[model samples]
Target: MGNRLSKIYTRTGDDGTTGLGDGSRVGKDSARVSAYGTVDEANSCIGLVLASELPDDVRALLVAVQHQLFDLGGELCIPGHAAIFEADIERLEAQLDAFNEPLPPLKDFILPGGGEAAARCHIARTVVRRAERETVNLARHDAVRPEAVRYLNRLSDLLFVLARVLARASGHGEVLWNHERRKA
Candidate 1:
């Protein structure tokens, strides 16, 4: 990792191909690249959520998640690299439970809107789901750690809970879906 990114533009991807962490080149549209690229997109979405006002604990959790996502991206970039582990998934589950414990039980479906920050968290949650799908697709073609997939699965759940927490923290509360609302 020494001086690897000293120069920003390498002009090497002009051919629609990119290099992996193992010095191997593949098409930019390849499954592996798409998988890791989606993970990066999810990370950026989380960063957007972080840019707004948030609870202290939520802020810390998201910051750590950003780093974990970087590791997940690395795991996808390197064919045999093992960045995600069992403990990481366990941590996410524990955090999810802690944040969700005080929340009221959901009897009605909830919409994405809760407030600006909460809405953004919902968007991040969707992107993480997409990343999980992409990673699962990549697994169909190559070796992928089960923990990686499990991590993404658990992360999306954590984000969903966090969105609810943020909504409450911002005093917007949950926006329940109105199934009986008249539609034009």
Candidate 2:
């Protein structure tokens, strides 16, 4: 872990190809690269949400999620690598349930605006959803661990719940969609 990237400006990718964890070079726009890049984007969005003031428990959970996302990215970077597992997916499901338990059930569609932190969380949730879709597309043409896909799926769900929790924590509650507003 010491200076793993001491020389960050490597000219290896000047040919429009990037190196993978296994030392193989692939096009920058390859499916694998796109999948992992989306995962990285999701992690950054989560970081933005973490920058906002949040409850301690929520903060801790998001920190853990960041690490897991990095692992998931690593798993995608290296072919045949297994970083995400059933336990990771299960943990996300448990967190989702715990966070969702105290909130009233949804009666209408959510509009993704509750508070500053909650809005950021919603953004993160959508990015995670994109990551899931990209990973699924990659799986169509290559080998991918089932757990990796499952982890992204559960993580998106957890992010949705977290957004709701953050919204309530910020005293903004949820902004429900008005299906019939246009008729008014």
Name the candidate that leads on TM-score: 2
List, residue by residue over 1-184, the lDDT tens digit for candidate 1.
Answer: 5887789999999999999999999999999999999999999999999999999999999999999999999999999999999999999999999999999999999999899999999999999999999999999999999999999999999999999999998999989999888875
Off by over 4 Å in 2: none
RMSD of 2: 0.8
* Clash count (model 1, backbone only): 0
In candidate 1 the C-alpha lDDT for residue 184 amounts to 54
Q: TM-scores across all candidates?
A: 0.97, 0.98
lDDT of 2 by residue, 1-184 (tens): 6869888899989999999999999999999999999999999999999899999999999999999999999999999999988988888899899999998988898989999999999999999999999999999999999998999989988888889888988999999998898995
Positional deviation of residue 111's Cα in model 1 after best superposition, in angstroms: 0.7
TM-score of structure candidate 1: 0.97
Prediction RMSDs, each to the true structure: 1.3, 0.8
Q: Residue 21 deviation, candidate 1, in Å?
A: 0.4
